[model samples]
Target: MGNFAKGYSMKDRQFWVIVMSLGGASVFVFAAMYSVQPLLPFFTEQFQISVSYASLSMSMTTLSIIIGLMVLGFLSDRYGRLPFVRFSILLTIIPFLLMPLTDSFAVIIFLRFIQGFAIAGVPAAALAYISEEIHPQSMGLATALYISCNALGGTIGRLMMGYLTENKSWEIAFLCLAFFGSIIFILVWLTLPKSRNFTIHRRFIREDLYGFWLHLKNPYLLLLFGFGIILQLSFTGMWSFIPYYLVEPPFLLSLKMISFIFLAYGLGIIGSPIANALANKVGIAKIRTIGVLLLVGGILCTVSTSLALIVVGLCIACLGFFTTHSLTSATVSRTASHQKGLASSLYLVSYYIGVAAGSTLLSPIWLHFKWHGIVIITVLLPIIYLFFLNYTLHKKMP
Candidate 1:
């Protein structure tokens, strides 16, 4: 285990190793989760399914994550953090490695479910671990860095999958993912220090159960959880249809060009900490409101025919999503200090529930009304969510 001396916490060798390893793990986890998104159009053509059915590939994974987060979140609170997190990373690798061997879409979707279940260990445990281990003064920055890594991972994974699948095959994309994923897996397994702050406890005890109950009852946390769900639903629903939108009609963009569009996710890396800093001055409620407005504005811009305006809109939407996500995620822990792991799990439960629903539901709308219908669905949620957030903050703060 790494030393916990003052020198070690203050940007020493061990601290950097821990941060870098966690960041690498963040990249791998999201990459594995979202890499399939860019392949949705190909899935439709190959499987002879509608856009709605093709979306099942991504939806199934997120739905599975909901189950995993629920189970692992509570279990991690009882068991130590390191074991669950390590096991999660290791187990997630199996599905990706196996992806190349499958031709059946059903089998592939099933594997994605298993992969989501495995990766649940990361988010369910990582935030709790960071809060437990990182020094209080640097915790915000550490968490922001992790969020940045997530954004980068997502961007890289989508671009890599889209490009490789365009040039070679989807199987080739999965193989490349397996290769890089394994290396990052080993780095995290070797470098992430064992938990310095966790106290192992018996599972399902009365006190622990009561702690979870209290978190569920807290009005502030419930509001934040609602906000998370709405944000993810809007964000994921919009993205789930992008490849389909660009591949047809007026755009006719290749998979490579569509992949390049996801590079907009890079804005999240800048948005995460900037939102966090602004939250300190303007407060979480106002910042969240602003984020919702930006997101709505971006969605409106996508209705334009111009490619340049669409890309600009995508960047704005990504920033808004990350800004809201970073603040809300941090607040989950703060709202339930005694049940941080459980609270984190619940927040993710809400987030993924939104994702699964949005991906599946919005696609059918796309099938009917096309992009205009999608824009209608995407733009409405954040406006309503922003108003709700304002009311909640007023009630709680007053």
Candidate 2:
């Protein structure tokens, strides 16, 4: 058993091991989850489906992840965190391997759904693991680093799949992803230390349900949960349709060229830790609000016809989204006094629901209004939610 009497800090060798291992776990989780996003357009052309229908390749996965987070998170709370983390990565590899053997789109979607549920194990348990194992002073930075890895995984996954699909075949892409997942799994299994701080809860099912209900009843947590939905809804909605938008526009681009746009996600890698550092100086709430404003502004920028402006807008949007997401995620861990695992799970449930909603719900807007309509709705929703967030926070303050 690892030492749990004292939390690991930046100065300790074990701290880097834990953070890097968990961070790699996060990378694989997200990489597997979002790998198909760039392929939405390709799926549409190949399968002879509509844009919205093709999006099921993405949404179905997120939808399953929502369910998996609840189950895996609850289980992890009772069992242990490390097991779920390892289980998630191992499960993630199966779908990728099987996806290449079948030509049926429905089969692929079913496999993606299963893959998504498998991917949830890591996220369902990871934040709570960090909260318990890492030193309080280092928690924010640790969480930020983990979240940044989320962006890195997503960017890498999309770019890899996109490029491979354009040059080779989507089947080839899935095979490569499977090979990559294997490497990540080995590293995490070997390097991730056992949780010393985890206190196994052998509670009744009824008691766990009640714990979930209690978190739902907390008004502040509800606000944070709501924020998670809005942030991802806007962010995902923008990225989901951007490929279609670029493929058709006056400035037509190939899948290979469009894949490069995911580099914008790199800004997310930078934004998360920077947001954490700034929050330390100012305040989390204030910085979070600034992050939202940046998101709103960045979305509006994409409305422009200029390609340069659109690319710039994407970078800004990624930065803003990650900044808000990193802070919101950390705050959720801090806010829940009990059942941190359940709270984190609930927060992610809301988060991925936004992902599902953005991928599917925004389809009509893209179908009818195109990029203009998407921009209007995505920009307006967050700005309105920002006011609501401020009002709720003020009302709660003494």
Candidate 3:
């Protein structure tokens, strides 16, 4: 309940409460958004659809989230952050409950889209909330912790769905996720503090539009936003197709085994906080560059036929991806001089657009080139972007 002028620090009980609540809520949000990833092949089999078509289940959700982030982020700036955060979790449960009852693939995709839009509320507001409410000294760690939970949630969801689908059914997997979401919702409601630092922007629609335009016009901010797109495009593209790749050829891993691969995401949980701490010492740019290099290197390692190497590569990839992501996101929150909610939303909009594109747009690469093709494109894209990012930052700094 405390919202001091200096914001909550590590020593405060309220600080832990807020961080844990938001972190828990983030876990549910990301888990619901990404749980369908491991089940793409199952959907392909169940619906008798193409691999690309089954990917729509993942893409459609992220696509809807893009739209939701813009609208909800704008609204949160006008109203409040806490409401959208609360409402997002509540809305997320509905689709999980509904998806299991339907037989049609179209219906399932539509529900997933709704669920993705609902999931947007948290990212749109939560980062902005942390920037406004948490003490600056602790904000880096706080953001990293929240993002780490995001990784944890995605890992849990994929693992849970993969396990349940293999043993029981995909339907049971979704229902179980819904039940888990309800538990997260209750914890969030009880523990989340009201925002003390948020100042309502009651301005007209035109003014808000201008604020968005200003953010878009800032070259530095645009670079960060583009970085978000590149980071997720490669990361999501890698994960989206791995299940299919492992289920084929010499590897031929089962869905249950494939789910365990997400344990690499545990590296992401550790990577964020560590990267944030290092960025404080070596500089964010240096850490981010290292992160991108790690990402590229890890993707290349997957070319090895050895199963152990593939898993090791994935661990490296997860670490790099989360490190870059956590730093970029925290920087975005700090860079915007005003309308932090809108700025955070724009970053995520670009971020999830990468998710949608990686899931669906890369289908052709998967189709024609297979895993090798995927490796080429995913690796190349980030490297190309990293050069661009460094060059841009270097020019701007002097």
Candidate 2, superposed: residue stretches over 4 Å from native: 1-3, 396-398
Write model 2 residue lDDT over 1-398, tens digit each, in one string. 23456688888888899889998888888988889898898999998888888899899999999999888888888889999999899999999989889888999989989998999998888888888898887777788888889999999999998999999999999989889888989999999988888887889989989999999999999989998999899999999999999998686889988888998888999999999889989999899989998888888998888989999999989999999998898889789999777787888899999999999999999989999999998999988998988897898843
Q: What is the lDDT of candidate 3?
A: 0.90
Candidate 1 residue lDDT tens string, 60-139: 99988899887787788788677777778788788878888977888999999999998888888887787777777767
TM-score of each: 0.95, 0.97, 0.97
Question: Relative to the true structure, how large is the alpha-carbon lDDT of every model?
Answer: 0.84, 0.89, 0.90
TM-score of model number 1: 0.95
Q: Evaluate candidate 2 by giving its C-alpha RMSD to the native, one decimal.
A: 1.6
What TM-score number comes out for model 3?
0.97
Q: RMSD of candidate 1 to the true fold? A: 2.0
Which 10-residue window in model 3 sums to the lowest lDDT? 1-10
lDDT order, best first, reads 3, 2, 1
Clashes of each: 0, 0, 0
Query: How many backbone collisions does model 3 have?
Result: 0
Worst lDDT 10-window in candidate 1 = 1-10
Candidate 3 per-residue lDDT over residues 1-398, each given as its tens digit: 34488689988888899889999999999999889999998789889999999999999999999998888987988899999999999999999999889899999999999998899999888888888899988877788899999999999998999999998999999999999999999999998988999888788888888989999999889999998998899999999999999999899888999999988888999989999889979999889989999998999999999999999999999999998998898789789998776787788889998998899999999999999999999999999988987887788754
Query: Which 10 consecutive positions of candidate 2 have the poorest summed lDDT?
Result: 1-10
